[model samples]
Target: MLDVAINHAVVIDTEKSVEKKINIGIKDGKVVLLTTDTLIATRVIEAKNLIASPGFIDVHGHVDGYAYSGELSACQGITTTVGGNCGLSPVDIADFFARQMRDGFVINQAELIGHSFSLRQAVGIADPYRQASPEEFAAMEQLTRTALQAGACGVSFGLDYSPGASFVEITALANVCAEFNRVMPIHTRLFTQNDLYSLFEVLAVAKRTGVRLLISHFVYQYGTGIMEEALQIIDQAIENGIDVKIDSGMYTDWTTFIGTATFDEQTIADNEMRFSDMVVASGKYLGKRLDRELYLKMRKHYPNESVICFMGNKAEIYTALKKSYAMPSTDIGTYKKGEGHPQIAGSFPKYFKEMVKERGDLSLIEAVTKATLLPAKTFGFAHKGVIKVGSDADITLFDFEHLKDNADFPDRGKPDAKPTGIEYVLVNGTLAVDQGGFTGEKAGRIIRV
Candidate 1:
């Protein structure tokens, strides 16, 4: 008997961009059968009128080992998450995975060894504005290689947070990623709102190092009036034979720690961002808007607290993700129960609702492909993004007609509110979300690329 059988569902074949009514059988954490015939299983789900597809893979997130974040991700049909984004990750990649394996997690996690913050700090470079010494750069390179050898999926850089990270330091670590055939994801340095030069810098690195480059959170960086120009540049880079891809979320507003250089007074003034546009997403001042006094308090005492900045062109969000090389991402961070951005629970569902169902910007097949196979191919998770015989039995079943994201900003509504119409989610052949509620299944594995 099969371990689980999902019968009579409209299954999306991401590879072929087609949908068919099929019955799927799973056993030993792999898809064993796909057919019209009925099958017996230890547990069977009748899933008529629902759309079944390979589980969503989040290409950019900060949900490294946080259980609540994992729960929120699974609730939104994300079965595999690529964490250690934005240059922040555990120093010991192996230990992070080992701990997750020891004490099981809610979804599969593949990590990226971080450069700007984690690796730099690990090498004893304390100041973000100071260049790393030659010895420190060598040490970071060695640690990056060790992490990659120990199963890190890529190397990530948050250049804005580490303004002093020299291009030489970046290319050195990027070369190691290329040597190992791993991806290099960069959060570019946004010196100002109009910094197209930042994007070019990253493109230049990809051009020089010959490494596979993934730009983390494109919309957040260029969703201003410059999105058209940014997309044009990306298109040009791809045409020039540079392997470039980007990830974005549905919302125009973005969130990060208030203490980061991105939120510094000087950076804020340079970008012409209003203090009124920033809202506290976490910590004691959960929903309060940041004025001069409150902003200074948070920056000084609560530097690690997350703040949501509402900017960017809403139309540009759709425009960016409409690109063939663009994938949807959450940028989900570790947060307490009521303290975080709505993207944690809303991103994937919102991606479908806004891009496919409501706007008609993307067909259902195209939307599913971006959220599934595109990221899988980008990250090289060969077995996790397709629904076929012998593939990993990680799946999401949703009613597209009723799909909607209920989570809103902190001041607007419950930031972590669960979405609607996601019927069931499975991770490694184990039921994780049943009838829209999390089933407390720790079936997820640490995916070492």
Candidate 2:
């Protein structure tokens, strides 16, 4: 008998964009069959009147194996997440993977060895305002090589958080990532919300280095009414034969550590962002908007805490995601159950709701493809993001009609309210979330890319 099976389901064939009714059988953690013939299993799930698609893959996140973050991701029908994004991650990539592999997690994790924070900090570079010395740059390059050899998905840079990072440092690291053919996900620096020069710098890096570049959180960076122009640049780059991909989340607002260089007094003024525009998303100040006094206190005492910046043009979200190369991402960070940005719990469902069902901007097949197959192909996960025989048995079954995001801004309500209509999520043939809830299976594994 098969280990698990789902019967009477309309499987979403992402590659072909066809819905084929079949019974899928899983054994040994792989898709053993997809046929109409009778199949028996140790456990069978009745998927009648449901659509079975490859489980969603979050292409950009910062879950990093934190328990609450992992549970929240699984709850949204995500089976795999790429962590260590935005230049913050554990320094010991191998040990982190080993620990997660041995202990098991609720969702599969692929990681990028972060450059702006983890590696720089490891090499004793303490100030974000200072560029790395030649010796320090060489040391960082070596650490990146070690991490990539140890199975990290790629190298990630958060230039906005580390404004002092030089072009020399970036290109050197990009060359290393290119040498290994690993992805280079960058959160670009910004002098203003409309500054396109930052985007140009990254495009130049791709042109110069021949590395596959992933512009992380496209909407967050450019959704301030500049997405049209930003996308034009990306399109032109592609036209010029540069390999560039993008990922964006549902909401227009962005969240980040309150202490980053992006929040330096002068930097904040340069962006024209107001203190009132910031709302604490986590920690003791949760749900409070930042006034001058509160901002001062938070910056001084709780600088590491995260805050949501309400500074995006909502319409730009649709414009950005309409690009064929753009994929949905959560940008989720570590937070307690009740104390984080809504994206942690709401991103996928919200993406499906706004981009697909509500706006009609994307067809269902197209939406699922961006959330699934696109990232799998980007990261070279051969067995994932497909619903064929012999593919890894990772799938999502949702109630499309009822699927929506319930999580709201911290001030509006619970930012982490669980989403609706994710009925079942499978990882490696094991049910991780069943009937809109966690099943305590913890079937996740560390995926080496």
Residue-level error in angstroms, candidate 1, position 204: 0.7
TM-scores of the models, in the order given: 0.99, 0.99
Candidate 2 lDDT tens digits, 1-449: 89998998888999898888899999988998989986789988898877798999999999998988999999998999999998888888999999998888989999999999888899998899899999999999999999999999999999998888999999999999999999999999998888999999998998999999999999989999888899999999999999999999988899999988888898888999998888999999999999999988998999899999998889988899889999999999999879989999999999888888999999989999999999999998889999998899999998888998899999888988999989999999999988788887888889888
What CA root-mean-square deviation does each model show from the true structure?
0.7, 0.9
Please give, for residues 1-449, the per-residue lDDT of candidate 1 as tens digits. 99999999999999889999999999999999999997789999999999998999999999998999999999999999999998999879999999999999989999999998899999898899999889998999999999999999999999999999988999999899999989898999999988999999999998899999999899999999999999999999999999999999988899999998888778999989898999999989999999999999999999999999999889999999999999999999999998899999999999999889889999999999999999999989979789999999999999999999999999889999999999999999998999889999999999898
Global lDDT of each candidate: 0.93, 0.92
The parts of candidate 2 lying over 4 Å away from their true place are: none
Q: State the lDDT at 17 in candidate 2.
A: 86
